[model samples]
Target: MYRYDDYDQRLVDERVAQFRDQTRRYLAGELSEDEFRPLRLQNGLYVQRHAPMLRIAVPYGLFSSAQLRTLADIARRYDRGYGHFTTRQNIQFNWPELAKVPEILAQLATVQMHAIQTSGNCIRNITSDAFAGVAADELIDPRPWCEILRQWSSFHPEFAHLPRKFKFAVNGAKEDRAVIQAHDIGLDVVKNDAGEIGFRVLVGGGLGRTPIIGEEIAAFVPWQHIVTYCESILRVYNLHGRRDNKYKARIKILVKALGIEEFRRQVEAEWAFHKNGPSTLTEAEVARVAAHFVDPAYESLPATDAGYASLLDENKPFAAWVKRNVRAHKVPGYASVTISLKKTGVPPGDITESQMELVADLADAYSYGEVRATHQQNLVLADVRQSDLFKVWQSLRDAGLATPNIGLLTDIISCPGGDYCALANAKSIPIANAIQERFDNLDYLYDIGEIELNISGCMNACGHHHVGHIGVLGVDKNGEEWYQVTIGGDQGNKAAIGKVIGPSFAAAEMPDVVTHLIETYIANRHEDERFVDTVRRIGIEPFKAHVYGNRQTEKKVAHA
Candidate 1:
């Protein structure tokens, strides 16, 4: 992780002091609730349904063990004992007192973390692949670029108050694990035919009321022009993006209104003015940033560890966990271990303070003192040794973090729905809980195989329901809670939106509806085809027929 420079440190320290004063003023009655709302929001403090929520940025989802311990301390001392990890890889505390947020920011500053741009209409956290450095297949590590953008966008004078929030993601790998196509600005690090590194830039991708896959604006932008080209894109959106209505204020709306070609043309025109400007990255500057991300000292070991093999032979549960939670690392003898937060009966992505501390400890002991927050809302120790897998798993299990449901049905991705979010129409957590309860069989989940079950409480798609293999969107019908089910959505390299099967089901019927969909896939799928591939091959009509059935069959079943 990049250490804060002198300028960065000074800026954050001053902002904390400023927010402290603002908080004191608000508490002293100098500022009304309405008057102080935007100020608090810009500082990443939200007045939620129950209490104030403080979102702390985990830049590019990277954190040191010490930083993780600090977060755990904050969760324990300042708010509830648990914190929710968001899709953007940020952590949110739901019960932080409004008056204490500035103090929290002060503490975060000590660890080189802050809540800036976690909220508001400005450019938010710049996210990237969780397995960036250790992944076997990567064009380049993306954290350096992410950090550059983080510095450029933080408190940017001209773009600070955009019409709506903007999100950017960078992917250096072939797999779209970062969901780059679903961001406002997505950059893919690529190598040209001559083996020179550049970027494939995509613009206008977003999800809300209007979901879109970003269009390629620049196919091979040189590495030097990254910041310049990004500024150009933002300037185009800032000038023309809708501001009259919040719903249509995103850059996606602007891109839609102008067509991809015209949007690209406009961005190019803007780039013509700034491509070689001061924001352009120099080789020396790039080298300086890249220096912060030097590879860890790794020992050369065997491809397979005998200790891990022996443990796997003795413990079936441990074997299952290793199969699911462990990922192949680019280096031999090292593994990327995902600590599943989606345990049965526990809320997905919610980790207690103790658990966080334990993870921090294990990261220090076994993974070079580094941690990563995955977009799947899970925590990762990205450089664990194969020999230490059992000890790590035991520690995680003691902390209630050992759930072997990485890609299982019960491993749901859900937004903080009506219970917390002001935008939700219905509670999604309860629905997720109900489904988890109904499907508690680990063997069954594994048999069903890799499936993405995502739920969004509203149309904003925060949970990415549109891209789940089994997507559930909560709806309000006649003042009652309902869930609409969709199947065949995917968010990987071949990203596609799901198609709705039929009518919406009551909240109580959601579990059964999901069960029916899975059963339909199981029965109809040929050989080893996954749910998504089957749906794409046969289309949704067959699944629809099974879900709704024929008119006569439905009547007969109802009568029975």
Candidate 2:
């Protein structure tokens, strides 16, 4: 985990003091709503349907147990005793009083955390793999690179206000846990044929309104020049990206308007300005940043623990939970455990204050006092000892954090839709709950196998619905809530945007539609094929035939 130094601490402290006065001025009517809007957004405060929603940045989804405790305390004192983890790997408090946000931010600063750049048109939180450094298949630790970008982008005046909000995701593992292709800028840390460390850059990748898979802008940019390459891409987008229509303002639209070749040419031309300039990273700079994310003090132990093996044989429940929740760690005798927040009937990603405290306690006791928030809205203890697996599972089960469904259909990623966000067209939590209930049977879900179901209130793609194996987007149809369904969307290196089946459906028809889609997949799938795999293999037509034909079959749906 990265610790904030004096400079970092001072930066956050000053922001808190500055925002306090800004909030005071707004409340005193010295600043109008228009004047206060950007100021509040820059501080991660949004006036929602019910109250102000405060988003706290958890850089690269990494935070300390002490920070977690502070978050829990803030939720208990100022919020409704719960916080929502988002797909960007940040947490949101939906009911914070606008007047009290500065106080909350001040408390966050004490623990080296802040809400800066969590919202607004600036670069949002930098996301990475939950298993970044510790994953068995990792090529290099991405946390350092993520941290480097975090430092470079925060409060950078040049990119303070782009055509629209920007996002960056970094991945270094064989598996693309960071979903790089769905971001404005995606960096894959790779080694070239000559065995030199470099970055494979993907620009103009995003989801919302128009969902497009990213193109490979640069095959292998040397690691030292990644920052400059990213700056080049952003510079191109900042200059030419549409600003008049908010809907067409994204970099993705610009990339589509100008072909990928032209976009790459423009970026390459821009890169020449600072290709190996002072901004280029040096070995010392890399080491200085990486020192913060080195491997934890580990012990020599056997590959498998005796008690853990016995428990796997003795308890079927524990074994099932382990199969879904536990991932292999690079270090022997250690494991990464994902505490699923997608429990059935619970709002996906909502963690209560007590639950947050429980996770912090578990991290201290088992994972070296560090916890990683996942882009899927889950919490991870990345360094749990194999021998202590059962105890960790027991503690989590008691806390209602162990749902034993991590990548299953019931493990949904959703946003706080009509209930909290004023930008939402429909309620997302209810749709997620309905789908979770529809596939509540554990054995059935296990059989269905690795699938992503994402729901969003609107097209901002907060839930990343466009990349889910099964995606549900809420639409507003004549003041009523309707649902739009897309299938075959997959993330990772071979990322692909899902295809819309036909027209949208009423909210009541969503569960049935999902059920039929599942049935269709089961009927057509080959051995060991996942839902997304089956969708890709057989295409969306068969699933569409079953869902629309039987449910309304003739492609019946409502408004766009």
Candidate 3:
């Protein structure tokens, strides 16, 4: 993890004091709600359905054990005894008293954390693959690049208030775990055929009401110009993006209206001014950032540990956990372990204060005092030794964090929705809970195989429903909640937006509708085919036919 220097600490400390005084003024009647709106939003405070919610940014999802312990303490003392980790790799604490939020921010500052630019119309968090450095298939480490961007974008004067919020995701692995194609600016750190490092830039990718898969703006940009190129794209968006309607304000809408070629041309024109200017990075700058993310002290051991093998052969539960929640590490005897926050009773990505402390303790005990919040709404110990795998599994199982459902149907990604977010049209937590309850059987989940089912309270797509293999979106009809289904959406290199199956269904029908989609997939898929692959092969028609039987289809048509 990157430790804050004097300047970083001074900036954050000053911001906390500024917000504290602003909050006091608001409470003292010196500022009205309208006057304080931007003030609070810039500090990551939102007026939600029942109370204020505070979102804390975790840069590239990386945090130290000490930082985790501080977060746990803040949740325990200031708000409820829990917090929700989000798809953007941040955490939100619902039910924080408005007046107490400044105190929370001050506490976060002590651990080199803050909420600046987490909300309002500005560049949001910079995210990347959780297993950046250690993944077996990784080509480059994205942490340094993500950190450089994080520093560049925070409180940037020119982009302080763009048309809407912006996002960036960097991927350096063969597998796109960061889901770069779903971000406003997706950077794939790559090496050209001539063996020089650069970025494959994809601009205007986003998911909301109008989902879009980003088009390539530049096939390759040299490493020195990454920041300058990003600034160029944002400059174009700020100059031309719509401001009349909030729904049409994202960069994706502007890119679509102009077409990819025209969009690229505009970006190129803007980039020419700063291509090799002062913003261009030097070798020393990259190396300085990269030093913070170097490998931990790993032991030299055999690739396959005998104790790990014995446990896998003897214990069924342990073997199942290892199969689902563990991943290959680049080192010979090391592996990354994902602690499934998708346990049966727990909401996806929701961790209690006690559970947060447990993760901290385990990070210190097994990993190298580091943990990552994953895009799947899970927590990962990215450098656990293969020999210590059984002990890690036992501790997690006892804590109820080990559900052995990593890529299975039960590991859902969802948002707070109507439960907390005022912007949500319907509730998302209940639908996610219903689906988890419906698919509680581990054997059944394994049979279903690796599938992503995402639920969003509204089309803002906080849950990233547009990229799920099975997406459930909430809609409002006559002031009542209804759920819509989309299939064949996927992330990774072959990213695509999901298409709606048919008319929306009542909330009560969602669980069974999902069941029907799975059944249709089982009936049609060839041997060893995944759910998304099956949907792409057979199309959405079969799933729709199976979900909406003939008479129901007619009723749905009439309703539509």
lDDT of 2 by residue, 1-560 (tens): 78888998999899999999999999999999999999999999998999999999999999999999999999999999999999999999999988899999999998899999988888999999999889999998899999999999999999999999999999999999999998899999999999999999888789988887787899999989999889989999999988899999989899989999999999999999989887799999989999999888999989999999999999999999999999999998999999999989899999999999999999999999999999999999999999999999999999898999999999899999999999999999989998888888999988888989899999988888999899999999999999899998888867888889989998888889999998999999999998888888888899999987787543455421
Summed backbone clashes in each candidate are 0, 2, 0
Which residue pairs show collisions in model 3?
Answer: none
Off by over 4 Å in 2: 552-560
> How accurate locally, in lDDT, is each candidate?
0.89, 0.92, 0.92
| TM value for model 1 | 0.97
Worst 10 residues of 1 by lDDT: 546-555
User: Candidate 2, TM-score vs. the true structure?
Assistant: 0.98
What residue pairs are clashing in model 1?
A: none
- The TM-score values for the models, in the order shown, are 0.97, 0.98, 0.98
Q: What would the per-residue lDDT of candidate 1 be over residues 461-491, giving only the tens digit for each residue? A: 8899988999999888998878888888888
* RMSD of model 2 against the true structure: 2.4
Q: Report the error of model 1 at residue 23, Å.
A: 1.3
Error of 1 at 372 (Å): 0.4
